[model samples]
Target: MGVTAVLGECARIFTHPRMIFKLAQRELNVDISTDAYIDENRNIEQTIRADERFYLELLVIQAADEEPSTHKIEMYFITYCRKLSHNREASTGPDWRDDRQWIPGINMDNGYFQMHEYQAPAWAQHLNHIPSHIVKLTTLNTPIHRWSLPGVPDRFQVFIKRDDLSGAELSGSKVRILQFLFAEALRQNARHVVTGGCLQSNHCRSVALTCRQFGLTPHIVVARVSKKEELEAKGNALLYRLAGSHLYLSPTCSYESFSQRLRSLAGYISDKYREPCYCIPLGGSSPPGMFAFITLFQELIEQGLFDNFDDIVVSIATGCTAAGIAVGNYLTGSKLRIHAVSIALSKEELTKRIDLMLSDIGLSLGTNDIMDIIDGYIGQGYETITNVSANTGILLDPYYTGKGTQGLLEELKKNPTTFQGKKILFIHTGGKFGLFNGEMDQVMNLPGNHANYINEWPEKDIPLVQ
Candidate 1:
């Protein structure tokens, strides 16, 4: 039966003076006072219609009720309840179900809401808040480790946020960003995902792995750093291959060219698959992706690490992650200093990009006092820094985190007064797999020992018992 028919039948069957009695109908089963019934009814209807899967399951239960078999009816009812519970938990988080936070209400300023109370509307261009969603693909809450690294200023304490362990193959800041991007793709019923990055781009690999995990086909257009490097599948490229991603190589490495290529590739994929194609910008630095770090700030608040840091340092390329962090700080009214160490973009460029990103979320750098862009770390250009460093004893990718750490150390040495009495938290955005690529030759230059090296081995293999 149609939803209206079902609801009307419920109203007729419940026949009571008070509207609260109508809520006891089997389809709803909500217990609320008469005063709350109007608001509750609107919320209940919204919640029920939010997910089509839930509505379909309810219809299935309704259909099974007419069947003669009681066991079959119970099975359908149980299935519907399980789905309801799972969706509820995913939407409202751990134990905030009674609050009906998943039900979107009209915000006074924006006329939109989110699944979580902490999240604003995803696309709301308002002056109040940013956004987050519940399409979790990997486990988050990477532990923060305190560091006592050499050469750091005496009065400054350092902590590293281990985002490297965010997932197995999907580890890094990209995964957090992908959670929202892929969620939007799924909402659009997209069957193909089109994205681009460098040959060993960690972002591309993370997207490929996430797409495979979500039963979607990934098409990656990898911009070539070198002809030789393009020929080899190493680091993130290896993961792309293993994840069954359709790989394409582009000669241009510039973001503008890369975006144009992505658009063409997306069109091709849509035509080929006879399905919709979702294109994620380079580094997944879209507005939705920016929310990843905004939500991350929320996570840090929960961990009690929010107020403890005087400065938060991150290696920024496209600058979306840093922008999100800045927005979070601005929204929360915190005076946390956000250090965006440039990996590729210049100080002026980074500032402009970050300013634009902030403006996208109804925030501006002029009004927001959280942004601090530290450049001069783009040593030997963007593609030249292939030799990864381990100053923090954590596996920081050569592209982002390594350069960022180097910059942080140098900044500490040069300007001791700035970080003298402050606490610094460096974000370790993981790119461990990038070390396995052709860049290993450059990294192994000073090393006599390797991970595969053995101290001693038997002269002959032992025979099998069988």
Candidate 2:
């Protein structure tokens, strides 16, 4: 049907407000009078229709913020639709005529405006379960684009979600989780934000930067292998010094020990400063932080990325990001299998951490049911480089994204049936700063590729003429 015909019919059928308010998800919001609504709906609907390639799901309802008014009653027209392009067969979107799928705001034989509350299905309502108050720390809706792997089969399709571009300094999936963590920290009127991690930890860097932005002192409890490692200021450690973060270096690297130290440090700071100190757990992977990925899953659904990918792979350190995504997938009844490569902990230990995180969020899904924990890729240890050669030209750190992506590629090559011909999305969790930790010295010293270099700027003797 034409845009004008649909909107005109809408006006005649609904016995309610004169103004037609349109809200496009994550985009436009406009309040139009009857004449303006008619004129503008044509352009908006035509843009939305996209030559019938997209089917617009329009929901007409009374504005929940407003009460009934005689002169004018506010009616909202919400537009929602999923993009239809994937390796799998495309889905013909919902049929508007199907009454079961939608509840239209229409009143017959009554001139008075009526309010009809649209109750989303249980799965749809799952998106609303995140923590309400959140600090906007990272850039969201990061682009998801197709990626080219070196040795992948022709049939298989790979995509990368660029969570690494979330922010300049606050880059990575850690910043997303920290959004919730720091929000809670500020809410508690905290003077010092205490967190724990290793020497060159990305999580520690993110926490420190966020604390500086929030005008709170960042106290980082770092687990160190040696005193020299603690003394060296490089990579994320340099950022900690730049942000004026207080570092507490400890010899014990145990998670329990780190937690105890963080609590003790926060308590001491509280007593010394005579102010509240908020202690964020290691990697900010707590119940409050898990909401970051849960909400990110909702963003995927809105962007039409949820239905396209069959499997999602990510690197797991503390297991909070994986748990959040898995919970969101389980709640939405998605068939996507979540695969997490263990960057630090063993499969058993990481699974235990994930299980506990889920339990804190009131979910009780077993490891097998929620995600596929892929181990055997820890290499020498955490923050160490793996020897897998699956170069895709994308900048991934040696710590997290590099290890996780190499694991996925090895799986696709070794056991093709597991992921062959399946659309896969790999989440780049971001640890770019860790690359400068002197791990790639041999590779950097090796012979460089001289074929790409050309003398494009020939001496430029004429430049002095200016």
Best by TM-score: 1
Model 1 gets an lDDT of 0.64
Worst 10 residues of 1 by lDDT: 89-98
Per-residue CA lDDT of candidate 2, range 305-419, in tens?
6668888888988888888787778888888888888888998898777877776666756766888888888763222232322234567777788788778877887866765
- Kindly report which residue stretches of model 1 are placed more than 4 angstroms away from their true locations once superposed: 1-118, 121-132, 225-229, 366-369, 380-393, 445-466
lDDT at 95, model 1: 17
Instruction: Compute the lDDT of residue 307 as modeled in candidate 2.
Output: 65
Instruction: Assess each prediction's global lDDT (C-alpha) against the native.
Output: 0.64, 0.64
lDDT tens string, model 1, 1-466?
4333333333322212133234234445543344422332232222222453454445444643553243443344345434544553212112111122212232232211122223442333364334324355566788997876656778788888889888788888788888678757755667679998887889989888777655567888878644545456678888888887878867866667779889888998888767678999888887887778877888877777656787888888888888887777777876677788888888777776677777776664552357778888876221223222333345666677767878888888887665524788888888878767765465454443232243455546766567
